[model samples]
Target: MSDIRPGGPVFAPEEVETPPKEVSKSSKPASLWTDAWRDLRRRPIFIASCCIIAVLVVMAIWPSLFSSIDPFNARTCELATARQLPSAGHPFGRDNLGCDLYARTIYGAANSLVIGISTSVFAAIIGGLLGLIAGFFGGATDTVASRITEIFFAIPSILGALLIGSTFRGSGLGIWLVVISLTLLGWPMTFRIMRAAVITAKSQDFVIAARALGAGSARIMFRHLLPNALAPVIVVATINLGGFIAAEAALSYLGVGVQPPEISWGLMIADAQRRFLEAPLPLIFPAVFLSVTVLAFIMLGDAVRDALDPKLR
Candidate 1:
């Protein structure tokens, strides 16, 4: 046998033809997204919810892609297509003004989603900050914030939104009014949740350690406590999204939401109410869309809750 030269790419005694490392058949590699996707796929409700939401989102963003007619346009009498039943030309049939109902519904879905998403973001930011403040700092600060939240909570959300919407009607403040009203009432719940989380976190060893290490109050609260407390806040925010959508619809139905010349699912339902016996498609289509949107959000939230649950992991 020839002797291998020193430092000449010589293999160690144990390196020649080393057996491949054995991968256990029973144990699998771990991946965060893969595990989450597997868990989500196993739940039929979650899959269905995701599909429904995806379809709605697509419709909302690209109504023209799905339909030829302009959703906002009022078709002329020459079209002569008003009240036509669902068929090859008009699957969802025509509305009172001969405009394509399918096109309008798609636009309406988009409008509702916009309002819902916008309002939720506003509420989350305002409420989350207030909650963090109240929860992190106890004593007079907590008491004052708690009282303010209680006052807002005492008033029904719809009634409050109605008051704001009606007041700002025709002043080009349609959607903004609704968003501000909802945010005002929405922050209370988040505040309460944050307070509890802060109280619990303040007593933790890590927080105490940070404080002893010369971390400022703001640093301790924001850097250490807030991040850990965000799990519950996110879960609550997800569930609240459905509520926000439904609330917008309810406001519109009552003539206190998105005003005329602007389409919303609630407004569509309201318009459909008068002609229910004559042409039910207008009412039915929007109702179906609204219901599906709300249900999808709820299901998605539940799926997220399960996915985030430490016990399940």
Candidate 2:
């Protein structure tokens, strides 16, 4: 006891490390779509594509917002003003008939986007519902649906459209005819994808649990099954939407799509083809717009697909 020479305490409180609180098991996990949205936000491709698509959608809804030139005003043309090349005042040049190529091209976007989006949505809804019913119930329903989808798959959509377009006689209804024709053929692919998705989703543990809880078929399908099965369908629908727009152009070039004065890119391209050697800008401009629009949709679809797919993640 007499050996404590420094008059200081030898021991200090030992530093104690606190353990981290464990995550509670009762907390809900992030859903697939939630994770997908988070992943999409980090992707540059998704962002760029979304921007491009948004601009295009705005252009489609209100083309006058982009260009002040009247697309359908043929009286603005003169013999001397026809087939002029691109310049400062009239960028994108004048068409064979002297209409403003720039304005016409901008306006044409509306028709393409409307038909594409409308057709795909219609096909997806009708086909998805049928596929869901077939896949969920199985047996005779499945057999019939499978047969119908296969039959449609055997026929090329363009060929079917050509045949149907030729048979249908109408002046101003060419665009509607093309939409109808695409819907008829477009549904099969959507149906096949949806049927597969539904079959997989219906067998999941959550669906079984819902069944055990005595949920009816309609409730289980709408509340549980449809949400899970929608990702692939959405991707397919998005990708197919671009194809439908391109198809509208093709049909128009063939003289069966949106008629004169309606202002479609395909119609513009068709008019410029003959005079391509003299004024290539008119053709080039519309083609470029169409390419960019379709590419944007496809890229958007691909980004969405990658984000939604758990395997990819």
Candidate 3:
């Protein structure tokens, strides 16, 4: 201590005590939904499809929100406005009964979407459950279920729907009949896919490990295998939605689906067929809606398939 100099530190200047520099935490990556939204925003087709679907859904839910004209009231006639082309007031023109075509089309879209969506959901649920069971539990159960699916698949879906609809004899029953018929036939494809998936998954290391861990058969099948196998099923279901809608339209066109007073695109097309030369708006509008709806669903399904597929990613 007595020999210490002014420029020298006793222990290297006490190491100049300094705090460690703080490091900022890297920002967490965006979530899956955020990424999906960002991707969807970049797709013009998807954006347009979403917008069209939104408008249709809104029209279906709130028919009175856009217009005050009674859709059912056919007597309110402007004699001077009968069969007029698209104008400021009547955007879609008038129909045979001198009713506002735009209002009718809006209501019709609502009805069609309701029936189509309901039928698709019902069919998908029924078919998907059956498929899961048949595929998971092999042997006689699988054979019987497969045979039944084959029988229904051999029969034309529309014809089957018609026969069942005729047998039911009521509007509500008709809808149910169509759903049941479609489901009966629809299960075959799902069953084939699920069976293959189950077979493949059963041999996976995870499945073998689950069995080694004393997991029950049902637990292994449902908890472990099913979730992993659902990607393809989801894609199929999405694509099937469009098919169900088209099926409903076809049935309605044949006069076996949606009954009178219930506006259906198919029925609209059928009615407009007779007046093609006189007024093409009826046919053109409904056809356009149907075509666009189907295309949107197809595109959405493709996007989902690509997104969910690991190989694609």
Clashes of each: 1, 0, 0
lDDT of 1: 0.81
Which 10 consecutive positions of candidate 1 have the poorest summed lDDT?
71-80
- RMSD in angstroms between candidate 2 and the native structure over all alpha carbons: 5.5
Ten contiguous residues with the weakest lDDT in model 3: 31-40
lDDT for each residue of candidate 3 in 54-161, tens digit (9 for 90 to 100):
887898899888777766775654646656788888788876667677777777776677766775566556666677777767788889988887887799877777
Candidate 2 clashes between residue pairs 3 or more apart in a chain or in different chains: none
> Higher TM-score: candidate 2 or 3?
2
Model 2 spans > 4 angstroms off: 1-28, 171-174
Q: How does each model score on lDDT? A: 0.81, 0.88, 0.73
lDDT of 3: 0.73
- True lDDT of residue 101, candidate 1: 81
**Inter-residue clash pairs, candidate 3:** none
Candidate 3 positional error at 126, Å: 2.0
Residue ranges of candidate 1 with Cα displaced over 4 Å: 1-42, 76-80, 311-313
Is 1 or 3 the stronger prediction by lDDT?
1
RMSD of each: 7.9, 5.5, 6.0
